[model samples]
Target: MAEQTITERIGSADQVLGVSRREIMEQMIDFYKLGDGDGMRQMFEAYKNWEVRYRDGKRTIDETIELAKDNFDCVARVADGYIDSGDTTVGMVRAVQLPKSTSGPISEFYRKTIDYQPFDPNRN
Candidate 1:
């Protein structure tokens, strides 16, 4: 089978979870923007793995999303250092640097989810 596109994956996830893709994507972008590359990468991998398990009937969609959210929270904790310092601009820059630190699934997730646009620190 051909690899699924992000849109397809989002559609599948939304259908199963009964949520809008944009809502999920927006939350993901928020998490991605706030998270360091390593944490974001780990979160992406965890989500992907959970997605597979969900497909295989080994996980529930709620469990999968909760896992994703938990991973995202981990990254948020990491971002707290920057946020607490009142240097969120620098923090966002650091978060965007995550893609540079890794390749493969995380990078692909970042690229596709962000639509290949450069990270905008000003985006709220």
Candidate 2:
């Protein structure tokens, strides 16, 4: 029961970035382990501006929302890494490929904002 509860909590962070929640969580854990602040994650942790943050439209995940893809940023990015060994990760989503791999923890990470670029949304 306890284990299920823990999983349930983690599962709340559904992966809409095309990357599995587990994979994103692992990368986030690893990054935090190294003391790196995933600024992107912090910004939209608890449904904070999540609707307008990703796309721009009805912001409802119903059958109607699907039809609004063209009007919104429907096609989001995939989760990967800023840099990798080609075996563990692939390309970056944003940000420069820092030779040090600081952002490497989530370079190609799109949805979770752990990718190569910073997850700063211009919700202005």
Candidate 3:
């Protein structure tokens, strides 16, 4: 049988932009070989599905949000990055901080942050 194309398997901008579903699966296998847990597998699958859903049917802005809410819930905290920046009395930047677990250190844990863009010295 002919090998399936990435586009045929996962037709998503995420696949087009960077790695593909097959690649993600391969990476997961590698991680598993190294004794990774089921949690990692779950994360990879969830992330991949979200990417595919996000790219489905030329979705609109509202549709994208709805799709995202439906697919990935654990990492949805990232969307809440902008907590109380402007107009709010507190003026505090809120974010979701993942607790330290078997996955990794607390410092290395994923957290929702207002600053999405990478640090660029030239931009300033």
Top candidate, metric TM-score: 1
lDDT of 1 by residue, 15-110 (tens): 264444333334445555665455444435645554655564566776665555444333343344254454645544554565433333333445
List, residue by residue over 26-104, the lDDT tens digit for candidate 2: 5444544565455335422433323334554544554333332211111121133323333223333332233322333
Ranking by lDDT: 1, 3, 2
RMSD of each: 14.0, 13.0, 13.7
Per-residue CA lDDT of model 3 for 1-124, tens digit only, reads 9864332334334444354433543433344445544434344445546555556678775566544333322232222221212222221122224321212211112211111222224453
Q: How does candidate 1 score on lDDT?
A: 0.46
Models 1 onward score TM values of 0.27, 0.25, 0.25
- Top candidate (lDDT): 1
Report how far residue 69 has shifted in candidate 2, in Å.
Answer: 21
Residue 31, candidate 2: Cα error in Å is 1.3
- Candidate achieving higher lDDT, 2 or 3: 3
Candidate 1 residue runs with Cα over 4 Å from true position? 1-20, 56-124
Which ranking of candidates, highest TM-score first? 1, 3, 2
> Could you tell me the lDDT of residue 33 within candidate 1?
62
Q: Which ranges in model 3 have alpha carbons more than 4 Å from their true place?
A: 1-17, 42-49, 52-124
